[model samples]
Target: MSLVNQQIQLVSRPMGEPTHDNFKLVEVPVPELQDGQVLVKHLWLSLDPYMRGRMNDGKSYAQPQPLDEVMIGGTAGEVVASKHPDYAPGDPVVGMGGWQLYSVVDGGQRGMMRKVDTTHVPLSHYLGAVGMPGVTAWVGLNHIIAPKAGETMVISAATGAVGSAFGALAKARGCRAVGIAGGPEKCAYAVNELGFDACIDYKAHPDLKSLSKALKDACPDGVDGYFENVGGMIMDAVMLRMNAFGRIAVCGMIAGYNGQPLPMANPALILVSRLKVQGFIVSEHMELWPAALKELGTLVGTGKLRPRESIAEGLAAAPEAFFGLLKGRNFGKQLVKLA
Candidate 1:
């Protein structure tokens, strides 16, 4: 049977915030499978903040998402056709399959595709809780912050993919997990659903002074550790509440992902608090993935780690979903359901 693949390609690099005009949908005929190849029908596509940085034409942690190409993304899917001995039709897998309906995967390709066990952990989880976002939270908290029992840890963008996992993991480890989110609903969900100790609605507290006051109230003992997903003012507030010898993991700067340049409020806080702040890309730390994935997978499978998602219905909704993600419109993990 002949298969046609539908894909969304990066047609233009966005100046600041991305829009529908930056992408183009294209259809192509799937080629015949080679001896060591398989065709996967993508079921879910992960839309994340990191892709925003990839959309820009500049130097950063990774290479820019090239123009006129399939936009970078993670996908979970089922093998529809296989010529390789190891994979059979209907095998569930997850990989960096980009924004497409089907992905051509090579058996010889080591990291791009991996068969995932969905009996305990759902296949969609390979893109979120049991996937990169989960690993990111684990590495940042375990390696960088290293929060101990009874310590207070703050997370910004607290209801999104990385922060939600971070909050739940922190709580699991016996730390006081406090969150900073955009709206009251997200704030309530962070505390009520994610079990965060407290959640501050940044929208209600718009200015630096107001947010700092809220943070001080939330972290009465001061912030012993911080999982930074949003930078700018939220970060500034957290810094002010940092305890002596505090630790910080700079996971992302979502607040400044757009073209805006947000300067740090207090550069001297690092020295004053004797803070340890480290920035990392989870992909670089491949050694820790096995351990992290094991723990995260178990937590997700057992219902200990409850991660939420904002799923878009089709491949065409990718751009709009991603746009909302950048603006903190997404409730948890933003995903596109391709099938």
Candidate 2:
């Protein structure tokens, strides 16, 4: 084994869009494991929109990523060395190992490092569809949307990890799923491949008026529930189309994550439509993870949920890949293949 461990660190905070200078890749000596600790060699690293919030020093659901420390993220890997009795060498596990080639984790905490069964679902799925993103979709849908048959549900960032999984889950539950993606290709994939009833290309209709018209056209019955991912003009358009008593699960506001604060322009719509808007963090609801993951895993295992991924080749590509994700350049879940 190599003596050095390569990792990415946050060198600076981004003012708006993150630049290459914000990250620094460095190599460090691998630390020796202590009692009840295990060493893992990461195979995959997940780059998510939520990580952007962690970069800033402002208050958030999670703490900011300390400078010069490894960037925070989810990773899937095999235990290469073990001092913990429960974890043997070659055991497959997934956890929040951050942006590194190897991770040293305590077995007791392990970042919830449960063993994975790759015989059915691939190890990578444990990082995407069957992982946090997938469970997030489940939580929002089951707990928030609670859709009935024939209900029209719309989601923004429809080609992303959370949106794609949410769309599939809604479809399986007999609801009509409409998606809003950045490009035509992504929109097409959402409808044709992921089984979304319809998808609107936000890029094609740049203005709020045009996007609202497109959404109205796509969901003629009016939006019964909304899975919000980007809270900008897209959200304003959705707000205009929401039916009375509509429920919205405010999962993310990536449009304003960098520095812009795009507050809702249509607060009156919430009152006029009598909508119920709730924002939640998936990690806060660990009690529902077992049931949610079981359902998400079953869907993924049987091919019912077709989760797509846009994978970068190595850890060096992680920062660039994440930048692309912020600009809606990626087609699906953004991931880094470290191994």
- Summed backbone clashes in each candidate are 0, 0
For residues 120-199, what per-residue lDDT tens digits would candidate 1 score against the true structure? 98888889988999899999999999989999999888888888789878988999999989899999989988889999
> After superposing candidate 2, which stretches have Cα over 4 Å from the reference?
none
> In candidate 2, where is summed lDDT lowest over 10 consecutive residues?
108-117
lDDT of 2 by residue, 108-206 (tens): 983458888898999998999999999999999989989999999999999888988998899888999999998889988998889999999989998
lDDT of each: 0.91, 0.92
Clashes (candidate 1): 0
TM-score of each: 0.98, 0.97
In the order shown, the candidates' Cα RMSDs to the true structure are 1.0, 1.2
Q: Model 2 Cα displacement at 279 (Å)?
A: 0.5
lDDT of 2 at 115: 85
| Candidate 1 residue spans exceeding 4 A from truth | none
